[model samples]
Target: MSVDNSKDLMMIDNGEGDEPLSQRQLNPIFASVLEARLARRQVLKGSMGAAMLGFLGVGLAGCKSDSDSDEPVTDPGTEQPPVEQPPAELLGFKAVSVSSADQIVVPEGYSHAVIIPWGTPISGALPAFSLASTGEDQADQVGNHHDGMHFYPIDGSSTDGLLVLNHEYIEPRFMHLSAAGQSLGSGGVPAFDAQVGRPVDEVLKEINAHGVSIVRIAKAQDGSWEVVQSPFNRRITGLTRMELTGPVRGSDFVKTLYSPQGTATRGTLNNCGSGPTPWGTYMAAEENWAGYFRNGATETNPAPREHARYGVPSANGRYGWELAADGSDRFVRFDASENGASAETDYRNEPNCFGWMVEIDPFDPDSTPKKRTALGRFGHEGVVFAPVTEGQPVVCYSGDDSRFEYIYKFVSAGTYNAATADGSLLDEGTLYVARFNEDGTGTWLPLVYGENGLHEDNGFYSQADVLVNTRTAADFLGATPMDRPEWGAVDPANGDVYFTLTNNSRRTEEQVNAANPRAANLHGHIIRWAEQDANHAATSFEWDIFLKGGDSGESGVATNIGYDPKGDRLDADNVLSSPDGLWIDPDSRVWIQMDSGATDPFGNCAMLVADPNTGTVKRFLVGPISNEITGITMTPDQRTLFINVQHPGSGTSGAEFAAGNYVSRWPDFDDSLPPRSSTVVIWKDDGGVVGS
Candidate 1:
């Protein structure tokens, strides 16, 4: 999700600054490991620490997903990490300079164009984007705040494909023209009493703007992309009906008034990052979904463990959807308090139905998106699948995406076969939480019901219960709490798993550990690991620091060398902060995108490419002011790259926004228009592979 410096925005930022909800202190502190290794040696020698742990963690899954057409794109069964190619052979573009300009910047030889900004019609009535677009219009147009996305080529054609993307959140101040005149509440939302409520239609529009979009895009003869209207274009909004699959299905804990049998729910909220499954399905993660619900449990009837661990509010929800003036079930469901005699008769369990990865077959428009609960419930940033064999248990990884949260690995119970692989393989699996040790090694602890003290005495009655309260179970298992683990990428060239620890301002000096070496972690870092014997399903692995994201001029600064001074890759041109979005191209070039309010040397949030073999980092692209550079993908030929610029004017103060002064009006830089999040298509003037 795109983060901002605003103090009042509760729903945005993917809960990056939410007060650390984890109170259980039994988990091992990562700082202890670093202290043991570094001890009194304060003088950092080289940029890369001398102790360089060998691993090339890719930004994306490091492999190509299947084609959206009938034929498979690439066989995951035959996938193998090719021998590392030389850095000079892949990275051919000159580094772009950082900038504070309210526009995008790329290398001298590259060109870019914007397409499908928020409110651009893709299906149905095809409403043109304007401030007057209605709640119903949003259902047919592109959603606000584009985040994680993937490009599924149509029949192997680079020019035609289904471009599926996730809308992480919305900025109400910009969404509604009425908000410009009204006095605002937190995050510039129109101030209103809870009972009197926000306008039902306004609330409806915000909800309509919060889900996934699948649009058919084709390259025109002029070498530009445009939206193609067809049955393939669909919008799965916050009100779209979906199903709950796996062990958590039909469980009493999730029995809500809407789903009496506990088999389903409505909407996927706060989608952050996304990835393609081995079976060609797209997985949209449910991140920061807890902020959408309010549990008004009193002293007698307390909130459940699932709700409490996730920090469900006792007051108004982030958007106050529950307080819609019409009092419709669609609006009232956001209030998760006990309204009836029992949990089964109320919306108390509606929050439980969320916080899981939603699987969608982009090719099948009629298919209901399934929430794969077997992967466990938490703040899932995204899911990255490891390369699968012809007959092997499929493995994948996900991070909780909150401060001090642990990383997770899910191994499927059934084996994979290219001819028969489907979503069912994800239904029965072992969910493991990571525990990074002091010796630069890590263990994957299974969250099974009977094993590892996950029994009744420990508050886990079954595998469903264990997964429902996954964070608590990891705490009991003594997993290592990381610095807001955001996204994971398995190197397509090497099996090493890479995750971006996107920062933790609360981690004190005393809490510094090996996996998270910095205290007051305002600037984030990336950590990578290779599983035991190069096996994705392996229970043990060796870990190391890939890159530390910060500036020497910033406070709480450590030596820029990261963990290995000898391998210090961070230079004046490549310094970045809060590494939020990550993707590696097929050639093993790691692409890192930023999300914080970094300035000066690191100007705006930018995307940088790194050569894993040589540790050379260079800026690729920088976004406009007050926007997050996220959701990257490329054509099968790897010539055209697509990335999204989200929440472009988010940094403006509430007073400035109320006065109709936006921080940016990007893509459409006119005085009458507000900044709209949009996708950018970039290509080299020479038509060579992007970043080459």
Candidate 2:
């Protein structure tokens, strides 16, 4: 559904001595299921009543309306008849959510297998993965957790491309030493590690496993996708060197012992959902970046106030990398210290190196990654740009992947010139925070200088301060804090922005408001926005909830579930929850991927699809036991879909081996092969549109 961009001017900040949405109880009329369902029905069809949804003084008539002209209207107290379900097949193949296996199960015509797994050597120089591999193999090869990824076509090559995948995190057991090829923790420590106060080598290996990998893939004449051996298969891990770009480059906040000018940093960490820029660069977001350091109870940097804003607690050394060499000095420097002699001479600036958007040129392996620090740092899940418009500012949206965090956008300072082939134009941009108003309109608050009290004693002293303490700056500006925002994608047919707010457990009823309306949001929702006048870089927009995840049969279904593309409202019976990775396919089909870990009744994580226009959502595929379905990218031809099955045996520990039950023995078809984390491609046997 399209948004009414003409309604962007009525935004009101809560800072005008007015009660915050958190303070006011929801209006009883809007809170009713009948009202909410009606509102949602209107939302699904892309329209809302002038009186009810005109909160932001928006022109309700301007919204694209879903004409429920054919369906029989029912009373509020009555139930609607079930709509006819689509034939349960994807390209003539029945798609089933495999329940009893640790594998990707498909119907009669489809087959799946892994081309590469943990510890697999990318090149001859890289050591092969030992059956009982140590952390060393992890450094030289792929890491354990294979999550979100992208498939890029080779120049002039069709049906053949390089798959750039993300290894989100480490599986210490499989990565390190263990008898059954997996160990939770070792009974002994190496001599070098014992003296360092940290697992030095192990830490370094884990560090090296956290980035992206490029593997050449080719489609057989039979339509099956497989990896092709080539030297182009390369790994860009956490230890790989990267360059800093944008306004924050060489800023004092990012300067560290490694690169005093802050022009460079060691590597990317916790790389999650990714974006392929129109200019051909890959944008990898660093998520949960706050947990990587160890400072042990007090500020390591001399500046304590600044360190506090980034969630760098002195006593939180959970990673324990600091126990290695020089304990607190070598490893602790990454802890976001406040006890450094000075900002210029210490590692207090490390946290600033992360949370910003990092861009890599997959075509140019030797190119250094550029951290576009202008995209204010937080737990960035993914970045999705609007289609590039010639001579217009390049616009992109991102979500801060934390409970109550905010959504953001970066608009290039220079207008994009399609004729100009260089992608470097992304280096300069104006970042803005979203402000959703009670009146149904919104505004983008500038995160630049000379505005929003950014350069003064407004808790910041300079441009660097605003960029470094972005969250605090955003808070002061009264930006709307969403419910665990994750990935976002723009509609190819229209400019509407689609983003997922993965479940936020911290919110309570007291915090419930219109925009984010759940307490302990176990079932997350998707919020979509359209730019003013359909312009990518417009400072205003219109927004609404697109889909709500939960049991399709629950009571909240009536109040919580919005419209799916099928022209039916979601009920409490379907068990999809925690909507995470999102992508708008070439045909504008909204693909919704779930990362169900803590609260899943659906058994395992799965991939789902929704036709946003009619609000119709359907289960597409589910992963095997103990794995999350992530990193989905379709081939340029749109017939093949590549997905990552990460850590299928993740929770399995060495102690559990003695038991008859294993967390999972995944990718196990013949049962002779040891389970390995890998990427899988889903395509039609006859070679047609993936979800047909």
Q: What TM-score, over all chains together, does every model reach?
A: 0.89, 0.82
In order, candidate lDDTs are 0.81, 0.65
Q: How many clashes (backbone atoms < 3 Å, residues ≥3 apart in a chain or on different chains) does model 1 have?
A: 19
User: Which residue segments of model 2 deviate by more than 4 Å?
Assistant: 1-100, 107-110, 124-126, 131-136, 178-196, 221-224, 296-306, 325-332, 338-340, 421-423, 555-574, 598-600, 653-661, 668-675
Query: In candidate 2, what are the lDDT values of residues 490-603, reduced to their tens digit?
Result: 877666788888787667676665667677777788777667666768787766666677764431222122333333444322357888889988876777777775244565
For each of the candidates, give the backbone clash count: 19, 40
Residue 579, candidate 1: how far off, in angstroms? 0.6
Maximum-TM-score candidate = 1
- Give the distance in Å from residue 219's predicted Cα in candidate 1 to where it truly belongs: 0.5
Report the poorest 10 consecutive residues by lDDT, candidate 1: 1-10
Q: Score residue 489 of candidate 1 by CA lDDT.
A: 87
- Model 1: residues >4 Å from true position, as ranges? 1-26, 30-89, 183-186, 193-195, 553-569
